[model samples]
Target chain A: MKKHETAGPTLLRQLTYRLAVFTLIFAILDVGLVVWTYTSQPEALGEQLLTLEASKLERSPFLSPDELTGPPGARSWSARAVYPARANPDHPNRSGSLMDWTRRERLEHSIRISGVRRIERGGSPEWVWMELEADSIRPYIPVILNELLTHVALPLVPLLALMLIFNVLAARRILQPLRQAEREIERLDAEKMTTRLTEPSAPREVNALVRAVNRALQRLDDTMVRLRSFTSNAAHELRTPLSIIQLSLERLPESDHRTELQLDVSQLNRLVGQMLDLTRADTMEFDTGTILDLADIGRDIVSDMTPMAYSANRELHFDDFGSAMVSGHAEAIYRIYRNLVDNAFLHAPGESPIEVSAGPGPQISVRDYGPGICEADLSNIFEPLWRKDRRRNDGAGLGLSIVKRLAEAHHGTVSVQNMNGSGALFTVHFQEGMPESGDLKQTLPS
Target chain B: MRLLLIEDSKRLASLIRDGLQDQGFAVDWCETLNEVKLLRQLVQYDLLLLDLGLPDGDGLSLVRSMRRREDTTPILIITAHGELDDRVVGLDAGADDYLCKPFQLPELVSRCRALLRRPGASLSTVLSAGNVLFDSSTRALLVSGNLVDATAREINLLEHLLRRTGQVVPRPVLENSLYSMENAVTPNALEASVSRLRKRLKMAAANVQIRTVHGVGYVLFEPK
Candidate 1:
């Protein structure tokens, strides 16, 4: 049984392999022809010797005929004269008779010569013929191979090389659209699901694949839009009822149950707001060209939450090293800080002040002095709706998730770690520097 | 003081109206922008409590059109969208302040009062936080209904701090309010004024205290 191949050889390698096989087959054929020619040389050489002697005798019979010898391997060649029918009656051979010489030469020398011609010299005519005898034609082998190499193999080498190069370039040209599609797919993410692979000029097979992938992406984008809108609409719809509940609770006489109910309603409100924020972070197309100071956002969050923090018998503080300019949506960055601080307030001891700091770079961090997060739960803390204590109604556990999403939407990162001594630290790092006009537009939704 | 409330939800609007009326204000409720336009012509409400989401249209356009007519009436936006972008947009569209939904009645009342307390608004000139009061017209300081000695600079600092009673007023904001920009003011001048005011308030046994928020700013809060 053949093993399944996960990956095949590259296109260029496949073409090279085929070209090598073709060159090998051509070489074998050329060599076989050379060998066959070398093996039959003696027969062809004897016929050529006889023909040469007859022609020489016809041209000049009285002159000493040139020595009849074949190529370098021939041992020797000898010519014999025969009488013309008019010159000698009752001669054993007829003039220009090939059959008579063939019979005579076959009986004398193991090889036969058959040409008989009458040549006139000084008003007299005579017949002449020649035969060649040789031991071997081995010496011509190198010559034959050299001729094949120079005329066929040598030129074929460069031609095959050129063909390999042309094949590789042509294959690359043919697959260029696929490479582009691969890059486009690599760039696709939840944010860019709407982007489609657009290469109409690709080959039919690749274009079919591209179209299929595009359809899948379109379906995914449609689902995502529906999900986001559902979340947003649900959050919006909950706000009115929550407001009525809160206002109704406010009007009730002071009681422990009413106070608890108010807290519950506020918690529900916060959850709904976070849900809306999460949806917006997923879909909001913000201008990356707007530059904001991280220090200022930090200050705003600190000031805004100070009253609440104070009422809870906890303190909120802001520390700024310098102006930390970053390019992002100001509201998103503000949310990152606000969520972190809110999370810290939930965990930190009342007396211990939560420290929020920004600057030295495009970074902001919130630190809380409390029992640090369990090592096991640190990784799952940023997941939405995940809670350490599932029964606790204080938080819906969406704050950290929203923080993570908002940070990522701005091309930033959110990280959490246990501090040195009984505390947790959450930090967010944003990409610094203003984006170019082109990049800003690219960040916008299509 | 009379206030007009424009909100889409009937129950929430009635609740807010009742809450505001309980806070000693004449509150009129409407559910659409068109009614707000009609009511504005018939009655001179001191404040407009606008909800961003109304039945007829977005309240933002109403706020924009009102400002276009150069109407100085203060508008406070009550919204369900509490994101900073919405707040900035509302304020940029000429709304004086923003309050998110599901807020405590006290918070809503405080925000409304803060907006009405602005210089040209119909609220009284005297601003009070805890047991301390400062008369902006007379530049007089009183602790527990008794007049207390305070310098001009101290009075200025107290007025700014009293405006945002429980909130942190950034140092730059206090400095700009206390001293003219053209004044070659010393670096510690505002701090010096704050320190003297704190001492005077302490001497007078004022219920309110000016607390420094480290490097950020100051907050005036009633001591427990």
Candidate 2:
């Protein structure tokens, strides 16, 4: 809710952080699965097969050949037991199974008998148990894995990689408009209040936020309207009575009553006029917008006040300003001018010439030779009713404050610094124009 | 010289008319813009002191419309709104000058006379602030209509001051005007001349002000 705070995290940084997190977590899980599988059942199963085969070979290694079952009496009592015919198997058998075997047969089979019988385990016999179990269970494990490596994982790796890349791309796509909106908000300018956020076609989550900001701006505009009304009203209210009193004084004779009264009234009127203008300027919109010739306003106020400057023994001079133009209410811009010139005249003590100049950047500076404002007070000197010294009563203490507000309205800024030794320099800055069509235009207040 | 006053209020118009008549300037007054326009078309008044507020139309717009018709008669704007911008606008609208309201009638008369006399040099003849008047052509000085013989230095300073009235002529510029580009003048001499002039100007006879602008220089105010 604080004014001028920046929205956090730009799109570029958000994308980078998200991609890194995804890659890191994926690598961890992939390694974890590999480690878990490598330490499981296969190696232990291989060793158990060797132990069981040794035990089976020690019991009844040769007797199982005569009848192949019933321990020479368990099978074939009808045909009588002779040499079990190898030719009946129609080529050498790998596992000599003839009938359904119970769990006991599988448990009782020995590794010693496995070598003597024509089990066909000559080539790569170390994996015989595994081979036997695997052969009996399923063939084509190598074939299936080879096909998976070539036809599945090979293509899937690239597909998954593309998905991850697209995730980062998608996130940026989704956030791009919002990020732009945030940046636009960050760049909201008081001088450019007429400028609003070009609300993006964004997620609905952010729609209300945009609406809220626009509403806030609407309120500000409404407040400014009322403030201007009050200012205009206040000026009239003060002007009427002052005018009446002046007229009444004028009707009096040319006696001491007229002279003394007129002198005091003159001073009083000057003070009141300055104060009212200050109040009006304090609340006026920053960019009511009119292009002004700075060269023009500077020329006028300087000439008008020159007589005062001359009487004080201080010279008033304007340095050349070439074709410098500004945009703002002409009156407001003049207020900026009056404050700087008045300050210069008040301080210079007729010793130094006030040198006012406009620069290449459409900027202007007023230099003086009076004792400069204190460094501590410089920051707040533009605040209303800010008087460094309590005793001086020439002004209502709003001159410089009006200067600051008027400058801001033009989308410009003003700064003051100490002159070489005993004076102050006030600088007003304006940016170059942005090619607004047509020649310069000025508007009068309705 | 007869002067025409355009004002909307009856009491204010009569008050101004009476006060101006007492000063010996023939004063004719009107209470509305239409009447003022009718009068302007007929009479050849030396000056027009126009009030900005009217019963019928804007006084400023009227001024602008008059200028559009090539009416170059001198105009002095009197208004209740005294913002600097207003003064600028009035002048830009072809007014010869502007005065914020509640003015001294003597001041107003004097201003009209000055504006009328501007084509010539009658205004420079007399400094009227304290009834001090110096006549260059006659080589005479008068305070409240009584002639007072002045030292030659005072006379010389008064003549120069009158010519550059209402402008701060720098001490250097004044010195240059006095001594010329080749006169090797001493600092003490200029100070002595200015000091004597200041003392005499402040004397009750003239209340003629020759103010020293601290470090800058000196200026004599334009007579009002």
- Which residue ranges in model 2 land beyond 4 Å of their true spot? A1-177, A191-193, A199-212, A249-268, A279-303, A306-337, A344-372, A389-393, A406-446, B8-31, B80-88, B100-111, B120-219, B222-224
- lDDT (0-100) at residue A126 of candidate 2? 16
Per-residue CA lDDT of model 1 for A1-446, tens digit only, reads 23335478899889999999998898888778766774566444444445545665666545554443334554555666654565566776654332424322443434434555555676766566555554444334445655577667888899999999999999999898887787677667777567788855669888998999899998999999998888888887788789999999989999999999988898999888898888887675655457788888888888888878777777777899776888877788888998899899888876788999997788899999989799899889999999999878899899999999888777788888898877998999888765554345326322
Q: What is the clash tally of candidate 1?
A: 0
Which 10 consecutive positions of candidate 2 chain B have the poorest summed lDDT? B121-130
lDDT of 2 at B4: 89
**Worst ten in a row by lDDT for model 1 chain B:** B177-186
i-RMS, each model, one decimal: 1.6, 5.6
Report how far off residue A265 is in candidate 1 (Å): 1.8
TM-score of chain A of 2: 0.55
Task: State the DockQ of every prediction.
Answer: 0.64, 0.21
Model 2, A141-240: lDDT tens digits are 3333433455556755686668667877887777676767776777765433455666666766666677778788878767766776677666666665
Put down candidate 1 lDDT per residue, B73-139, tens digits, no spaces. 9999988877648888999999999888768888888788788887789889999988998899999
Q: Is the docking of candidate 2 incorrect, acceptable, medium or high quality?
A: incorrect
